[model samples]
Target chain A: MRFKWSNVVLFFGYLFLYFPLICIVIYSFNESRFVSTWTGFSFKWYKALISDPIILRATVTSLKVAGVSATASVILGTMAAIIIARWGAFPGNTLFLGAITAPLVMPEVVMGLSLLMLFVGMESFFGWPSRSGNITVIIAHITLTLSYVTLLVQARLQDLDNSIEEAALDLGASPLKVFFVITLPMIAPAIVLGWLLAFVLSLDDVVIASFVAGPGSTTLPMIVFSSLRFGISPEINALATILMTILSIAVIMSAVFIYKDGNIKNM
Target chain B: MYRIEEIIISWFSELMKKIKGRHFLVAIPYGWVFVFFICPCLILIRISLAENLIASPPYTSLIEWISGYMLQIRINLGNYMVLFTDEMYIRGFATSILIAGTSTICCLLMGFPMAYAIARSSEKIRGILLMLVVLPFWTSFLIRVYAWIMLLSPCGFINNLLIRLNLIEAPLQLMNNSCAACIGIIYAYLPFMIFPLYSAIEKIDYTLMEAAYDLGSSPLKAFFSIVVPLAIPGIYAGSALVFVPAIGEFVIPELLGGAQTLTIGRLVWNEFFGNMSWPTAASLSIILLIFVVFPIVFAQRRREAKLSIVD
Candidate 1:
C-alpha cells in the first residue's frame, strides 16, 4: 500500500467510527463494576443485565415499539412513496409532500415537545388513547420515520422502469393488479430496507419517547439516557454491547441483501 | 403449471377490479400523516399561544364556549413575548445554533475527505467502506455517546493512557463541556455528511477533473473549480441534515455537557420535565423550529424545482 494521504484519511476515519464500538464491546466483558476500569474478562455484566428487570422490560418495550412502528411506517411510507413517484400532481399533492418530509428536517426536541402537547390535547378532547404509552410512542415513531421510508422508496420507484408495470396494465390487468403483482414486488427490497431503517431509528430514539412516555412505558434509550446522567455503568455497557451486536447484524444483513439485490450496484 | 397460472391470473384480475375502485391507496398514509404528524405541530402552535396553567394538562385552552351563540377564543401572545423577553431562552437558541453550526463544520471537514476517498476508490472497496460508515449508525446512539464518556472521564482511557505515557500531570476535562458535545455531534453525524457527499462526489464525471487537468489547472485549483461546485447540493443536504438535528440534540448535550452547557434542546427538556412549564417549552420549540426549518426547506424545494426543470 502506497502512503497516500487519502489512504491515511480513510484509515483514521474508519478508526474514529469503529473505535468506540470496539471499546464498548471489550469493556462489556470487564469484571470491574466501573465502566472505564480494566479488569479481567467476565460475563458478570451480561449476567446482571439478564437478571435486571428494568433493563429487560425496557428492552422489550423498545423492541415492541420499534417493531410496531417500523411496520406501520413502512405501510404508510410505501403509500406516500407511490403517491410521490407515480401519482404525479394530484389534489393536495404539494401539502402531502411537505407534510411527509417535514419531519425529516424537524428537530427531535421540537417534534417531541409538539407531539406531547398533541397527546395532551387529544386526551382532553377525545378521551381516547387516554394516556401516553406504547401506543403513543409507536405513533410518534411512525411519524418520525415515515418521511425516511418515503424518501428511500421514492428514489427506488423513480429509478424503476415503469415499462414492466405498463406492460402488465396493457395486458388487461387493472392498476391494482399491476401494483400488487408488479410494482410492489419490484420495490419490495426498498420496502424491506425502509422497514429496517425505521426499526433502527425507532429503537435509537430517546428524546421523542422521553416526552411522550407515560408511567411504566420506559424504552431502552430512555433507560440508557437516564442511567447516563448518574454516570456510566458496567451493566449499561453490557446492555449497549448486546444492542450494538444485534443492530450490527441487522445492518450487515441488510447490506448483503441490498448488494445481492443490485441496490448498491450503482453506488 | 399453465392451468395454475390461468387460475391465479383470473383470481388476481377479479381481485384487481375490486382494488381499482379504491385507487386512492395513498389516502391511508396521507390521512395518518395529517392527523398524527402535521396536526401535532399545529397543536404545538396553538398551545404556544395559550396561557400556562397550573392544571393536569398544564395549559389553558385557547377556545371557550361562553354561550350557546358565541365562542370565546383566547389568543395569548404572552408565551412568545416571554420567550423573547427572557435572556435565557435567547442565549439557549444562540448557543444551540453556534454549537450545531460549529459541529456541522467539523463533521464536514472530517467527512468530506473520507467520502472523496471512498468515492474515488475501487468498486469493491467503496461498497465495504460505505457499509462501514453506515454500520455504526445502527448501533444505539446513546451507547455511542456513552463510549465517549468512557474514553474521556477522569479515570477513562485517554487519561489513563496519557498518564502511563507521562504526558499529563492531571486528567483533562474532556467530558461535560460544549467541546465534548461538539465532538459527539460531529461523530454522530459524520456518516450523515459522508453519505450525501459520497453520492454527490460519486456522481461527478471524472472526465471533468481530467479535462481541467489537461487544460493546465493545478489539482487543487481543479478540485475547487470543478469538484466543489458540483458537490454544493450535497453539501447543502448534508449540512441541513447535520445542523438541524444537532441544534435540537438533547441526549448528546445533556450527557456530555455539564451544568453550564445549555442548548435549546436541553432548555426545552428542562422547562417541560423539570419546571413543568409546558407552554414555555412549546413556544421555545416552535420558535426554534420555524426559524431554522423554513430556510432549509425552501432551499431544498428550490433545488428540487431546478432539478426538475433540468430533467
Candidate 2:
C-alpha cells in the first residue's frame, strides 16, 4: 500500500508539471479563434507566428543579446571559478565572492532597478552609452548569468583532481600553458554547460530586460509578455510550443552527448 | 589553419607574459563584478535616498557642492518612510510573504513524496525520472507561467472541459486570484524543491530503513524519525530557494493574480513604470532585499554548521 501510494503521488506530480504545457501545445493546433473551444485542427497560428515581424525582430535581438552575453559571461565566469577554486585566498577575496554570488539571490526587480540607475548615472557622468540599449541589456544579462556559470564551473573545478595540472606544471610547462592544455580541456564540458545556461537565462529574462531595454530594443520575452497582458492568443501558444520543442531538442542532444562522453571516458 | 592557430597562440602567450597570468586571470572578472554588481547595489542605496525629480533619470542629487567650498547633503528619508506609512505597500509585503510561504509549504508536501519515490526507484528509472523533473525547467520560465494562464483562465482548458461535461453552469473563477498565483508559484518552484530533496534522500542508506522495519517501527514513525531528520538540510535549502524567488516573483502574480495580489515585485514595477517614480521603486527594492537577505544568510550559516558537524 505504501509503495502504491508513493507511485500515485509521483504520477500526479508529473501530471501537474507537464499537463499545462501539453495543454498549450494541443491548443496551439486548435482551429477556433477562441482558445478554450476546439473547432478543428489547423497550423494557421504557427504560420501567423512565423509571419509576425515584431516577434521576428525581437527573436533576432534576443539571440544577439543571449549569444554575446553568454560568451562574455563564460569567459568572466571561468576566470572567477578558477580564481575561487584554484587560488587559495587573496585580498578582497570575500568581497569578490560576495559580488559573484549576489546576483544569484538578488531579486530581479532589485537588480534591474539598480543596473538601470547605474546606467543613467554613467550616461550623465560620462556622456557614453547615451541611452540604455542592447549594450545595457547585455551588461545586465552578463551580471545576472555570471553567477550561474561561476557556480557551475566552480563546482566542476573543485571536483577535478589537482594532480593533472600539477603534473603538467612539474613537467616544465608554464602555468599558462598548463592551464590552456590541461585544465581548460578538463573543464570544457562545464564551460559549455555554463554557456548554454547563460544563453537560456538571457533568452528567458523579461523583468531585467524590461527595465534596461531602450526604445526599439524589445526582446522576445518582452514581446510575448506584452501580448500575454491582453489575454490568451493562439499565436502565443504556437510560439510556446516552438520554444519548448527547441529547448527539448537541445536538452536531449546535450544529454546524449554527455552520455556518450561518459561511455568513452569509461572505456 | 595551423599557421593561424600558432600565431594566435603565440600572440596570446606573449600577452599573458606581459601581464602576470595569475593577476590577469583574477583581475578581469573581479573588476567586472565590482563595477557592475557591487557598484550598482551602492547606486541603488544612493538612488533610494534621493528625492524624486521631474527630469530624465528623475531623482535629485543627494550630495552637492555649494558655493565652491561648502557641501550640502539632501538626504530624503521620505521614500523609505512612505513604505512604512502607506497601507498599499504594507499590504503588498504581507500578501507577498503569505503567498510565497503558502506555496513553499504546498511544494514541500507535493515534492517530498515524489522525491522519495524517485530516490527509491531503480537506478535507470531514477535517471529518467530526474530528467523529467528538470526538463520543464529548461524551457522558458515565461512560457511555463503562461501555461498556467491557459489552464486556469475563465475561458481556459479546465473551464471549457468542466462546462462541456455539464458539471457546472458557470466557469469557475479560477484565474486572476491569489489562489491562482499560489498554484503558479508551487508549479514553477516544485522542481526546485524536488531536486534538493532527491539528493538528500538519495544519500540515505536503504538498509537503515530496513533496519527500522526489522525493529518493528511503523512506516510513518520510521519516516518521521529517520527520513525527516536526515532530509532537514534539503528542506531548508529547497524552502529558501522557493520562498526567496517566490517573494519577488513578478510575472506569476502580475498575470495570474488580480489587483488584490499586489506583490512587492509588481508594486515596484508599477511604481517605476506605471507611476514613473524611480525613488519609490528603489526604496521598495531595498526593503524587499532586506526581507530576502535574512533567509539566505540563515540558510548559509545553517548549512555551514551542518557541514562542520558532519566533519
lDDT of 1 by residue, B111-199 (tens): 88898899988887777888889888888888889989888877778887898789998988898888999989988999999988999
Number of the top DockQ candidate: 2
Model 2, span B104-208: residue lDDT tens: 999999999999999988887787899899999999998998999888888888888899999988999999999999999999899999999998999988788
Q: Which stretches of candidate 2 lie over 4 Å from their true place?
A: A263-267, B1-19
Which consecutive 10 residues in model 1 chain B have the weakest lDDT in total?
A: B18-27
After TM-score superposition, what is the CA distance of residue B31 in candidate 1 from its true location, in Å?
1.3
Where model 1 places Cα greater than 4 Å from the true spot, the runs are: A1-3, B1-20, B65-71, B207-218, B301-311
TM-score of chain B of each: 0.87, 0.92
Question: Which docking category, incorrect, acceptable, medium or high, applies to candidate 2?
Answer: medium
A165 Cα displacement, candidate 1 (Å): 2.2
* Candidate 1 lDDT over residue span A53-108, tens digit each: 99889989999999999999998898888889987987888998998988887888
What is the Cα-based lDDT of residue B47 in candidate 2?
A: 87
